[model samples]
Target: MRTFQHKVTINDMGAITIFGLGAFFCLWNRTNSLMVILGCLLIIVTIRAVDRAIHTSYVLTDDSALQIKTGRIGLTKHILLSEVKSVEKRPFAFHLGHYALIEMMNGSVVSVQPDNVDSFLSALKKRIEKKDNEV
Candidate 1:
């Protein structure tokens, strides 16, 4: 019956480093300047996307509702507690860094990267269990 909420911050060191190296390479090897510039831009955009993903927060209430808020597009999605068919805690996967995927009854999934995923999963499970017992 606990309201669990978590927010995760994006770490930009990797992106920044890649962009810097790409810039350096672009200047040093002018033969492929366009490719290097494109790589750098791609890295920058990837960083921004990751930042948006990480900045998102998830809120789970005792009523079985899951709410997510992403900073970039100012979009918030709410999934009813009964709508979530399953909650899966996935470890760091390919290109996912480290995040969790919540699957809904409709077969749609939402990804969330919380700072403490283990704790988040534990709390979510506990709440769900409690709710089930109440019914």
Candidate 2:
């Protein structure tokens, strides 16, 4: 199996900035119990997001499946390599990060964001070719 780390992008930074500001303001005011609770919740959620981002990775398995562990909420998804028709690299509109759009045989597309677009594409293409040859 080949593993790739997830790169920290602008989305992550934005989340931290927004959440931090909210939490800071809420805690600083010390207005009411509800606001304090909400601030605490935001802090917890932000920490969880940071932790997930640090540990997130994409795994291309030997069984012709790609395992995705996204940083957001620790979501995990699997896509069968055999079902993939093609992969195209798409850059973010803001030019912050890169994602690969995988077109499936079922006419569905799944986008995956990886740390290194070229490396991820190379590894995925190699696996797909190997799987194709075995069939």
Candidate 3:
């Protein structure tokens, strides 16, 4: 089994922080409380996103299942290799860019960006192929 921990890029955190603060300032002291609420929501969203990213981790099992876990919200997902339709590796763009997109047989998609994406993909392919041989 191989495990990878996702780290939130500094650039991403900085960008989100700046944007959230800007929104809060713009909406502050507004006549209606609705605007303030909206600003707070924005900031909350930013915090959640960053928190999730920081806590996200992946586990690749020998049986060809990839487990995604986010400690922040206690979210866990398992994607079986047999059910995966396709896997795409994307070159990193900005700080918050995702590395891989896994499409499942049920038409749903899961996105993950492990710290070492190339190695993750290589290991995943090997595990999937090994499972197929066993089957």
Candidate 4:
């Protein structure tokens, strides 16, 4: 099994912190309860997103077949390597962050965002090559 793990980048942290602080300050100064509630929700969302970003990891295992697993939200997705048709790194758009599109031969696509995009791509490519060689 080969594993690739990465934490949220400093840049991501800084952005999240700025957003959280802004919401907190707005909540503190606002007199409306609805505004305050919205601010609180925003803060919660930001924190959760940051935590997930930092904690997410991916693992690839080679047996008779290949298995890919991604960890997040106390759950892991197991995918067979033979099912994967291709992997493509797409450009960051909006809040999506850097994404890897795992295209399956059956025409299913799974989108994943890893903290260190370059390393994730490299590791995925290596695993794909290894799986292909085994076949």
Candidate 5:
């Protein structure tokens, strides 16, 4: 099995910095109730980004399954090679940039943006093709 780490994009860094700074400024001058609430929100967002950076990963298993693990809620989704219909590069709906989109035979789609997207896609495609040939 191979595990691919999540890519820390410019947007991710920007969000973390912005939220961290905002939280610091808000909490530093906590004279108003609204500022405290906003500070707490900012801290939550910053922590979420950190958690995602630390925990999100893609695992390709020897049994032809791709496991997508997400942080915070610890959600995991597994996709079998035989269930994958196609793979393409497109703008991810939930993210700021492009990612590898894997479409399943049942019409579900999963997006993945690994640290080395090209290598990840090539490896996944090769596995899928090999699985196809075997069937």
Candidate 6:
């Protein structure tokens, strides 16, 4: 199995900024319970997002499947390699980070943000080829 780490991206930074704004708004509008609650929830989500990005990884299993895990909520997802039709890399304009769009045979696409695009793609392609040869 091959595993690759998830990279921190500008979107994550934007999320943090949004959470900060929410907190600021809550403080500005004092005595508003709903605003305060939303701000708190934002903070929790931001924290979990950052933590998940740092701790989570994309795994290519030996059984012709890809395993994605999120550390924040211990969430895991699996995708069969044979079902993957294509992988398109969508990079940021200035190289902040990239997302790979995995197209499935069912005409659904799943996007994954990983730290190193080459590593992720190479490993995925290798596994797909390996699985194809076995069949």
Q: How many backbone clashes does candidate 4 have?
A: 0
Task: Give the per-residue lDDT of model 3 (tens digit) for 32-100.
Answer: 888777777777777777777678899998767899997676678888899888788875566455587
Question: What is the lDDT ranking, best to worst?
Answer: 5, 2, 6, 3, 4, 1
Clashing pairs in 2: none
Q: Which ten residues in a row have the lowest lDDT in candidate 3?
A: 90-99
Clashing pairs in 1: 64-81
The lDDT for every candidate, in the order shown, is: 0.66, 0.86, 0.78, 0.70, 0.88, 0.83
lDDT of 1 by residue, 21-104 (tens): 765666567676687677677666656656554566777765687777665555878877666678887765354455678887
Q: 89, model 2: CA deviation in Å?
A: 0.4
Worst 10 residues of 6 by lDDT: 45-54
Against the true structure, whose TM-score is highest? 2
Model 3 spans > 4 angstroms off: 7-11, 26-30, 92-98
Model 2 weakest 10-residue run by lDDT: 46-55
Which residue runs does candidate 4 get wrong by more than 4 Å?
7-15, 63-74, 91-99, 113-126, 129-135
**lDDT tens per residue, model 6, 78-131:** 999999999878877687667888999999998888888877988898888888
Q: What is candidate 6's CA lDDT for residue 64?
A: 86
Steric clash pairs (candidate 5):
none
lDDT by residue (25-61, candidate 5, tens digit) is 9999999999999999999989988888778999999
Clashes of each: 1, 0, 0, 0, 0, 0
lDDT of 2 by residue, 1-135 (tens): 889998778887789778888888888887899889988998987788787667788899878899988766777889999999999899898776788889999999887778898999999999999989999
Q: What would you estimate as the lDDT of candidate 2?
A: 0.86
Poorly placed runs, candidate 6 (over 4 Å): 24-29, 93-96
Q: Quote the positional error of residue 83 for candidate 1 in Å.
A: 1.6
lDDT of 4 by residue, 45-126 (tens): 7776676666766666655233333335546667777677888888665655677888889898887766676777787777
